[model samples]
Target: MNRSNASRGGVAVLVLAGGEGRRLGGGKPLRRVGKRTLLDHAIERGQQWSDTVAVAAKSADQVGNCDLPVLIDQPGIGGPLAGLASARLLDCPLVLTIPCDMPFLPDDLMARLTAVLGNEGASLASSGGRIHPVCGLWRRESLMQLPAYFATGRRSIMGFAEVIGYATVGWDDHWFVNVNTPIDLAQAERRID
Candidate 1:
C-alpha cells in the first residue's frame, strides 16, 4: 500500500536486488518475465504491503526505473546478511526482506509475516519442508546482533535464524519459487503467467 495511506505499525520494505546472479549471467534483477523486469515485480509486490519500499542494488543504474530508494549493499556484496544490515538502518521498526527474483510471492505475504511477529523477533515462511529465508519479516531492533554474526564469518541465513529463534509460517511451496537461473525464470514465468 502507499505509505501515505498505510495504517499503523510502520513496516519497511527491503527488496534484495544486489545479487550478482552468477548463475543467470548477472543483472538478473533487470531480466524481464513478460512486460516488467524482475526487480519491478518485486518492488510492486513490496509496495503493495508497506509504506516504504527500497531496492538493495549494487549500483544505482541497476535498479533503473524504480522510484524507491536504492540502497547499496554494505561492504558491497557480502550476501543477504549485508542486505539485511543495510535494511536495518531504515527508519521503520519492521522490515520485509524479499528477493527480486521471487516474483510470485503471495500477496498476503506482509500480512502473514507481521501477524506472526512475537517476542522471539520475527517469523519466516516455510513451505514444502524448505524455509524461505529471504522472504522474511524482521524487526529493526533484532539487527543489532547481526554485525557480530557477520564478523564471525557465519553466512548461512538459517544458521543465524537458529540463534535468534523464529516461528515458521507455512504456505504453498510453489508460491515461494525464486528465479535464480534462466531456466528457473522460464519455469516461474509459466507458473506465474
Candidate 2:
C-alpha cells in the first residue's frame, strides 16, 4: 500500500503500549503470543500498514528492546490519548493508532479506516456494535485539540473522537479480540493455534 498517497499526506502507525496492565498482572505487551510478544505482533502489524511505525510507551523499561522509535506519554496523564499526544510529534500528516494487546488486528485496518475517514479527518474502528476508539486513523493536526481536552480532565479516546467529529468503520467482532486478562490470553492462544 502506498501510504504517501493517503488523504492526509503520509500515514504513521502508532502502537499504544503504555498501559499498566494491572488486570493481566502487568507488562501485558511483553506477554508471549505463540513465540512472539504481543508488542512484537502489534509492531509487525504497524509495519505492514505504514513505512513509519512508532511505539507509544510509558518508558523505555516498559518497551524492552523494540527497534522502532518510541514515544513516551506526557507525565501524569494516562490512556490511549497520551499515546496519541506523543505520536503527534511525528512528521507524518496522519496516524493510525492500535493497542498493543490486540494480536489479531485486521490486515486491512488502515484501508478500512481510511475509506470511512473521508473529510471528517478521523475515523475509529467499530465491531459488534461497540466502538474501538484506540484503533483509529487521525489527522496529526487534530491532535492540537488534545491538550485542552486533557486539561478539562477528560481522557477517554471515544470522548475525544466524538468532540472532534469522527467517522466509525464497522468490522467483524472476532477480528478485534484484545488480551486484557489471563483468560483472554488463553482464548487468543487457542485461536492462534
For every candidate in turn, the CA RMSD to the true structure comes to 2.2, 2.2
Candidate that scores best on lDDT:
2
Name the lDDT value of residue 104 in candidate 1.
88
Per-residue alpha-carbon lDDT of model 2 for 115-189, expressed as tens digits? Answer: 888777589998999999899999888888888888898888888888888999899999999999999999988
Model 1: per-residue Cα lDDT over 1-193, one tens digit each: 5555667348888999888888998888999987889998898898787778888877788778778888887773367777887887788988889999989899888878778877766688889988888889887888778877777878777777777888878899878888888899888778757
Backbone clash tally (model 1): 1
Off by over 4 Å in 1: 1-4
TM-score of each: 0.91, 0.94
Model 2's number of clashes is 0
